[model samples]
Target: MQAKSRALHEFGATFLGPALHVYAEAIESSGADHLPVCLAREGWCFHRLLKRLQRDHAIDLPRDPVYLRVSRTLLFRAMLGSETITRMALGNDFSGSVLDLMRKRFGLQLHEIFSALPIELLRFNCELPKDKDTVFEWLSPHLKALTTVVSPTRRALTAYLERSGLTDPHVRPLMLDLGYSGTIQKILTHTLKRDTSGLYFIATKPGETAVGDHQALLKGVFHEGVGWRSGCTMLDRSLLFECLLTAPHGQMVDMRQKSNGEFEYFYGREAATQRHFQDLKTVFDGAIDHVIMCRRHGVTYTRGDVQDLYEVFATKPNCIPHDVWHLFNVDDDIAGNGMINPMQMFAI
Candidate 1:
């Protein structure tokens, strides 16, 4: 437990050092008018920590960062009203059963999926071809029918965004998240029909290309390039980071407007169960404390320094506690990837 705590503290400082510097500069240049919004799930921790830092005089901001409850599923579903489904939204090189593909990628409920897909497709558990072109070719016939089902979600999401002040033309938003791919940022830019700035911890080379036209809008504070080539191995272990840096709540899957003119958010199953809650809380608390201490002590870390710390934490056997390995049941239901254990990658 102590070893895990210490490692997480280093993790916190390494990532936070770059974040604080970038955040201060962004706020300074964007002026007091732009709002900083944290993308939810992972950004929940960042928003809370930033607020605490601001209160403690460790960081200064003109206003509090807003916690935006958004997920890839919700954003993709929302965009179905206007945009065609792309390989990026459906997961590049996706390998899953047809049912899995429809449910996960389209964010379709069981009934909607059943009605849209042919009966034969549902009867057999057919795996999708991993090739990008093959999958899209197969999906071409069903695209219009599938997208038509979720059109209402797009309308409701627009209302929700307007309510959140995201759609206000005068208010520029700085989207914050722990990043590899800037998918959320890209979707927002497309859906909102406006340019958006995304501030991430790290953006990979592949992510830059994946973001397409919105690529220029993204800035990676810590490091931006191919992970192994650049020695930012931490970027490759995003699942582990997600495990450590997630919000206490479940992932937001859907949102709807009430008759009373209010928005309601619907969340999927909790990623981390109750049994693991206390352990996660301890690690998160320690990390936040470490960031605050570093800020107060005038200590800062570089990308290289963070890389070195991550290498030790990831490669050194028994450096992480035995119980910590069990804490890797992260649910990627939104992505249709299912539950994955990050530690399994090390076994290979």
Candidate 2:
């Protein structure tokens, strides 16, 4: 399926044309709100292609022209729509069995990360580890050279807790955030709950500044084998994602401040200035890209003592969360301003 999709997508430009646009134009010209069910289904390419192909053939004819040329007699283009073309192109395979096979065999990868394990939203709270050095020993193998691994370490700690019986009331969700299988969706369909909590997991995407600062909203969750996977190689960032599960409340946190530091790209203007001004957003249509992560800084842990969470990196992470939202002080303590700890980086 992946190979087929790659083949199809590489030639995707050829698949689309003015056919839909022309239909839309015609519909608007006729000014109809409701289109016939037959007409509405024309845009999708769910039909199967013939297994055999001629040495040479024209795939270039306009859809309307093809309908006309093939029919020999004059007929309204609208009258003969997608289904006829699909059936003809498919050599009368109207059952769509090929399409169903393709659809079931695979679909587009939706999440940035996928795991055989469920990405469960486990909730717990803890201070800095008393014997923190041994916390990440299990995950050291997956860690990149010179890269401090955080997620797996925290995960090792949690699993250790479970094994030692220190982690009471531990509810494992249907899907966890690590391992070979990459999505919660597949796991939910494939496995039954091993423990209570019904094998279901809940999630909300990482935190944001515009949201209210509530203790319940600010803590964290932990994930294993998940960080290096995200292309975030700096050690600190990975730790932040893990700390979200260990916060005081059932809140979730993520390292959002990585880009709040310096970045340079060569474009029309100084890309640094462009990015700096992106979050400020005074200019509507300037060089600022409306990327979803434009506002992301280093990850923040919610609910627990922020200082202890800051210590998890084995070095100081820049107090970026406080600095970005604070005013009147570049050196404010409450709003971790002007701090960038190298240890905080999970991956390079």
Top lDDT hit? 1
TM-score of 2: 0.15
Runs in model 2 deviating more than 4 A are: 1-182, 190-202, 206-236, 239-302, 306-308, 311-348
The CA lDDT of each predicted structure is 0.66, 0.20
lDDT string for model 1 (105-159, tens) is 6567899888777876655443333454555665678778776787667778888
Q: What lDDT is reached at residue 72 by model 2?
A: 6
- In candidate 1, which residue ranges exceed 4 Å CA deviation? 1-33, 81-87, 120-130, 206-216, 227-231, 273-275, 322-326, 334-336
- Choose the strongest candidate by TM-score: 1
